[model samples]
Target: MVDILILLPIISIMIGLYFITLGLWELREGVNRHQYIKYMFTGLFLLFILTPLVWMMVNVLL
Candidate 1:
């Protein structure tokens, strides 16, 4: 539980980065790169969501 609370947002950030990479890949040669940029932002937004969860966990757990 403690580990998860600590790691979820970190993991989310990494996942977000992965999406960004995908977006960049699309930008380099994809016909529909803008769609991927949208996906990247979605991931980034989701990562933001994870931050509060981690914060709440810290408040509750310790």
Candidate 2:
């Protein structure tokens, strides 16, 4: 959990950046505003789930 707590924000920011990029692309493609926000939030939620798994994998590998 300590690993998770510490890593979560970094992972979230990286993921958030992805969503922002995707949102921008979609916006250029004329995607709806609602859908844009949805994808961004989904990415954030995924980050929350992925961070702990990533930390565990790194610890195991190294």
Candidate 3:
């Protein structure tokens, strides 16, 4: 339990980065295909990347 808690933030940050990378990749694919929905996905993934940071900040602030 303690180990899981210690690693949670690190794991989440890594997952967030992964999503950001995927978002960028999808953005490129969208541009190549000239699709608008890809922009939405890109935005979503970017938001996901920020989620962990935001969560950490809020926890710290509170």
Candidate 4:
């Protein structure tokens, strides 16, 4: 149980990084095509990626 708790945050961070990479890839295409909505969605995707890390931090700190 303790090991799982420690590992959970690491796993979440890895998943978040993956999403960020995906979002950036999409962002590049959006930039090339001058698509506004894609930019917004990509930004949202990046924000969503931050959620897990933020949650972990809050839990640890408080």
Candidate 4: where are CA atoms >4 Å away? Answer: 31-62
Every candidate's lDDT: 0.75, 0.71, 0.58, 0.59
Among all windows of 10 consecutive residues in model 2, the one with the lowest summed lDDT is: 43-52
lDDT of 1 at 30: 76
Question: What's each prediction's clash count?
Answer: 0, 0, 0, 0
Query: Which stretches of candidate 3 lie above 4 Å from their native place?
Result: 31-62
Show where candidate 2 strays beyond 4 Å.
31-33, 40-62
Candidate 2 residue lDDT tens string, 13-51:
688678867877777788598877787777766566666
Candidate 3 lDDT over 1-62, as tens digits, reads 55655566666666656655665676677655434345445545545655566567656655
Candidate that scores best on lDDT: 1
Question: Number of the top candidate by TM-score?
Answer: 1
Which of the predicted structures, 3 or 4, would earn the higher TM-score when compared with the native? 3
For candidate 4, lDDT tens digit of each residue in 1-62? 56666666666566656655666776677655445445545545545655566567657865
Residue by residue across 1-62, what tens digits does model 1's lDDT show? Answer: 77876777677778877777777777777789678779778777766776667677777877
Q: Which residue pairs in model 1 clash with each other?
A: none
Segments in model 1 whose C-alpha atoms lie over 4 Å from true places? 47-53
Sorting all predicted structures by TM-score, with the top scorer first, yields 1, 3, 4, 2
